[model samples]
Target: MTPRRGGAAGGRASRVRRAVILGVSVVLAAGALTASPASAYLPGPVDDPLRTAGVALAADAAADTGIAFGACPKDSGLAAPVQCGKVKVPVDYADPGGRRIDLLVSRLRATGPASGRQGALVFNPGGPGAPGLWFPAVGLKSAGPVTRKVWGTAARTYDLIGFDARGVGHSAPISCVRPENYIHAPSPDPRTANAAAQTRERAKARGIADGCGRRSASMLGHMTSADMARDLDVIRAALHETRLNYYGVSYGTYLGAVYATLFPRHVRRMVLDSVVNPDPQGVWYGANLSQDVAFEGRWADWRAWAARYDSVYGLGSTASRVQASFDLAMRKLAKKPAGGTVGPGELHAAAENAAYYDQRWVTFAHQLSRYLHGDDKPLVAAEAPDRSGAKAAENGDAVYLAVQCTDAAWPRDWGTWDRDNSRLALRHPFETWPNAWMNLPCATWPARAGEPVDVGAWSAELPPVLLTQSERDAATPYEGALELHRRLQGSRLVTEVGRGSHGLVSIWNACLVSRVDRYLTSGDVGDADARCAGHPVPVPSGTLGAKDANTGRYY
Candidate 1:
């Protein structure tokens, strides 16, 4: 999950944008594909599951009633020439005629010639709730060099498609609380909460769950990734594509995997980055626990980086000393929150970004230094709870819980959670408690949990898939990628050795980028798996800019 926090100011946004543009420009310069007819790579056959469900293939009718692409919706944040459209799909594929929801989709049409056009390349930016309508623009706007190259290559031969999954973004969005009431009330620091405080935290989690049931119960049950995968088929037929070319990051990898399992023949080329664990047993509860351990390691990496620049940051000269400094700062914040708004929880939330991307290490170190020196503004600005985007954040959080909490059965007994999380927290204190609380709502999720798709069931039937991961990715650890690779019989795995970043394709790693570019452009997966050296640890260069600092909560 992409941890939610306030973003950096002007410096970060400009820097992120510049990085994106530079990466995209390089990608556009890569070699192009030889001309080929679009029909050359049509899907072979429909799986029995889809064929049996009469409504499943009903979307094929969309071929006759194509999407009406027009001016992009103002709220979509898309610029001119990029068209927006909608496709109506059943809220429940099991009962296609029951209720329907509109899926908001955007398209950046292929820029290359008609004969060279491959088809639509669908994208999912992985929140399980992150709005993806802005994804197509990400290639031209903000991703890293290699990611941009892959996008650049696709843009030349494919019409890139981005959409808000059902019950998210502009597609009949669901929210558990109203913006004005969705305040981030301070809670006791998770790292130090006692039994009574733990009980109170559970109550808070239960309250959130109850609120979701009360406010958006109608849509909660339908938010599973399985249903979302079905929605993708509807989108495929609507676009008149015989096969889907997909790129999924984070939670999106799971969605793509489900789609491939359900409709194996309908997939042409697929790229899954930062893969989610495909083990049915680890559906989500176990996955989050695993993340706790991984995040701590990444956090340690950040502290070590800070120690390397102790003269610049004045935190400490050794990783242990940096940890001590961080502990001292936390104690001070516990006594009195910076700016009276950023308490321990908020500060942790802001600093946790360091675990997700090394790009934020310098900025976070600076924020910590400033806070310790009595200038709390940077720390405050990094995590002060903003109410303006509360509705959007609430919607994303609701959907995240709606999907993850219901995707698989979570331990109903609060004691199981308390025991497991407490045990893990003892060894990995960085994000254990915070993550446990973030997912605590699952203990009493209102909807009945659905069984995760048997991801490996149709693995042998799938075409070669390309998988990428940074060895130390915090969100979806490297082990998940290995597990997924083993499950997907013929898939290729590209490991970014020693890196800890969450998403690989969006970073400026040339080695991984070239591999992805080659696969997407020529459908080559070589004879075996591949490895790429990770980009070196970023050195503090006079406090370079950050990325999407103000983007609301994501998972």
Candidate 2:
């Protein structure tokens, strides 16, 4: 799904690319997991695939999309969802009267003081490609308490909107290759040159992207931040709101920015989590560097923890020394691909748990230790998506690339990538080439490049915006947040210093909650340097509580 970039002004963390969330749903055909033709335009509905409640479509332009005010099942939990009906938007907004596609919209009425209702605080988990539909229903652990209040306990207070983008989720799938080709195939070998691995990866990417272009013609082109902004308008019309109040994380930040830029008056309040810097090359470069650096820092944390158990695990004391050991394993794998087929590329892909999700820290540490000592069994098992979806998530990786590539122009010449990557791998070889290979589809994505939005960070006319970012973060990187704050003359940045993660909202930070709640409720993010909790002492292995296991009492 690599889209030939039209060339966005912002790079990885800038443009409305997908947020750094967990897997795309496997709800397509058997074992075919996917996200968007490009991305679940606004990913609120991808994860929350609760069987939709068959409700009548909005009668007119300003009909109600809210269901909590209507009726819902009494029970809560797995069965407890506001449930929604489909509202169709133009497949291509350019030709509104032509073809149509469904945007799965849902809202859990406000649970706060009804007398003091704050309109709708729409939730977008930033995927331009992520399916955020489950934000309200299942709460994928990142929607934060602000969202919980909306769909809290049940549909007591707020109205949440979680829709799969035009080509994502139950709306309509875009898939090129089946998961078997990627998943069932051998894991990567890390030691050798990454370029050869990238070639195979490109083949898999094209299978998905070209398949999407072939399957959905016009829909493929409509998969951009610009058009999705139009979809927001349609969402507004259906919601019957004069303005849209939004909460976006990761790429969701960009989505909110786009919506605000396109329809400033339509925004009542917007909270962009994990702020993206609008500088195209610099941001992606920063994002790449940031991931390498942050992961390295976290790698140290993993090493120190391993040190505490030095007697249990043979890895050395310092993070640097432990990394040396892991590097040795990668070299060995490069020379002799494991599992009879898996290579360095697949091995790194399998080990990507370190890139996101703190839950995997212990497992990865233990697995890496064993793999270094010649036990490849648990490593393969460690790489599976949590729950296999109804079917394979279709075209997710493909759609991810398609939208990204088409959304902006990436360097085409393999030479450029060769040189750039050689440099990146030199400094941050841990996840460097593997991460580069993950995004290789961008090199030859099928779609025509679209234009990147040159967005302003601040504006006098806009309502107060809250920008939350985790300092020392991977992926989106916190430095970009400062740039966004600097650019957005009126924007205030609340930092989660040293958290070492992306999309700093959720995961429990009192400072972030205070800043965001103030802004959302009272329409203000104070003009001070607001700081959230920095990184805490690294949690030890076997100390992972219920939350890490996804068995929280709340869940």
Report the number of clashing residue pairs per model.
Answer: 3, 74
Query: Model 1's lDDT to the true fold?
Result: 0.78
lDDT of 1 by residue, 33-140 (tens): 211221111221232322224233246445456699988888778875688999988765544444578898899888778998888999998988889998778546
Off by over 4 Å in 1: 1-57, 139-150, 185-187, 542-555
lDDT of 1 at 98: 43
Across 492-540, the per-residue lDDT of candidate 2 in tens digits comes to 8877766655655545454566666667667767757688666443343
TM-score of each: 0.87, 0.76
